[model samples]
Target chain A: MAGSGSDDDAFVFPVRTHFHAMARRPGGIPREQAIEAAESHLHELHHEFKEWLDQELAEIAKILPQSADEVTSDDPWVEAAHARCQAVRDTAATMGFYLVTFAANNLCEAFDTIRSGIEYPLDAIDRDFKTLLLARQEADSADRTRLQELIRRMENPSAALPPAARRTPSK
Target chain B: MTRENLNLHGINFLVADANAYFCMISQSILRSFGATKIYEARNAMDVRRALVEQRIDFLLCDSMLPPSGGLELTRTIRWSANSEYRTIPILILTSDTRLNTIAMARDSGANMVVAKPVSVSGLYNRIAWVAFHPRSFVDSPTYFGPDRRFKIEGFPTGVGRRKGDKEFSVGEEDGPALAQDDIDSLLNLARKA
Candidate 1:
């Protein structure tokens, strides 16, 4: 459990100022309870967002092509996939899942550019989705750091990956 | 006021969020802050029904409600002929912090926009700011909401009254009116969502 006094001050968040201010008000909520509640919400979001991501990825599998040249931006299935991708971005951002949020954002931006008649690598989106799922399972800082490095390597494939981190893209 | 001193005896709150966990957590935070009679709405229709059926004082809404979402709901509450809560304080809580999203929130008549995963103090301060020390409401041809200006005399260089352009204030009665196209551009951004 994250103690209110320790966890609140440890994180450098701008909103904590607001929380402290409200906590001082004559009839405001306590800082400890608020932190606890927020932590609980984050736990639930992790589970729920994981389920949502799986469903979205399943849907994307049915529509997305193995190559970039086969689809247009206006296709109904593509549009639907974009919507789900956006939902993932928004929800992950809300939960403070920074890696998933970052990957989803880039994927959306790539799609937007592709829709505007720009030719780009479609494999990047799949790689980003895979990275999002990998980041989801990372529960520690070292694991997260390694995953971040893998994302970087995936982006710049010229960079070599360690033997333990190398893998084939399943989709 | 301290935690024990905080007194929300008669204040009624409505929290509109599609996420059940978020709703529950927000309610818990409010209750800890001494608030009672907090209502939850999961969708836009439930929000409308809650407004019509209850005497709601403050509204905390998520930006991504189903159907049309919260920005459209803000427009409806602000401009609807049948709404009695046009002047009620609305605070948008969401994780979408795109520049266009913030602009739409301002243009749609929201009192404040707080990013999600907010701290208790952050939520409380915004609610207190809205409830007690609100900015003057503005009803322009293309916009209707609390004044977007947070600073009175802190415009960046060359932007406002620099080089002695003119000394003036943007009160409820006097300000530069936004063009229709500018407003349309923002609404268009919301549509892209």
Candidate 2:
């Protein structure tokens, strides 16, 4: 009886209360205990996380255009690469790969801008790919911060750069 | 907001994502919360099959699910005329938290949109929120889904946009401003549930 109503009027379906009954059952573990267990499970899978991340990165690399001429917003490969970047963004942080998450997020934003008809420079995308590779190799916080700044510049080209960065001549 | 334990033992969950590792991560979190019957699907076709085969109580779907996307799948489920699962709660998980994407998910009838790189606490809180705060499904000409309006503190500009909306006078501000903790507690009350 949920969707049976006149199109001109709004019909309200009554709330389903069964979930409350099911979730409030007896013998539930403490909230902290549940979180700890889940975290432990994730930690146990840390070994596999590296392999998974590598595979995802390889897939993204494989799908990326080899040249600016090969890049097309409408291409299925572009979308595929974007989705893989999203997957890395979504899972990396949970496994303690915050730098990887950061780089993937930057790549996803770049992809979003490109999909919206903006003409993002190919060098920016290539730099993001390199940043991802560097993030995988470097775990130091200082190094991560430096990489993040590099991505920030790539994402916002017109923004004022640091004195040291500005002093360096354009490639 | 005091944390309350969740018992998801009897609640069946279907997690649909193209990434196998992501699916495994979701399953691990759900299992830790006491869920026993968790199903996995990698595409829209698999999702439909799971919905038909399993008595799914909840769905955690990736926004970029392959073939037909998650939003499309959600709309299909919402508009399905003969399916009991049409009204099941859906929570879309995504890394893209853009306003447009969130609006699309809402318009597609999802109960909630959870941002990804999901922390255990965040995931638990969202699941609890969806379970405890059930919204009334709206069946209108243009939309067939949960009422998109999450709050009814009278529309801004003191006017309603819809034809049937009732006109109401705006009341004067009352009482002192709430502290940040109070606001957080109110927003995260489901964590206590």
On DockQ, the leading prediction is 2
Instruction: Provide TM-scores for the models.
Output: 0.62, 0.76
TM-score of chain A of 2: 0.72
Write model 2 residue lDDT over A1-171, tens digit each, in one string: 444442335566655745656876666777678889999998888778878888888888888877874344776677778888988887988876777788888898888888887767778888999889877765334455676675576567657566566555569
Q: Mark the 10 consecutive residues where model 2 chain A has the least summed lDDT.
A: A1-10
Q: Which regions in candidate 1 have their CA more than 4 angstroms from the true location?
A: A1-25, A31-33, A44-71, A114-121, A139-171, B1-12, B17-42, B64-66, B93-98, B115-125, B139-143, B152-193
Candidate 2 whole-model C-alpha lDDT, 0 to 1? 0.77
Clashing pairs in 2: none
Each prediction's DockQ against the real complex:
0.10, 0.41
TM-score of chain B of each: 0.75, 0.76
What is the alpha-carbon lDDT for the whole of candidate 1? 0.64
Docking class of 2: acceptable
The candidates' interface RMSDs, in order, read 13.6, 6.1
DockQ of 1: 0.10
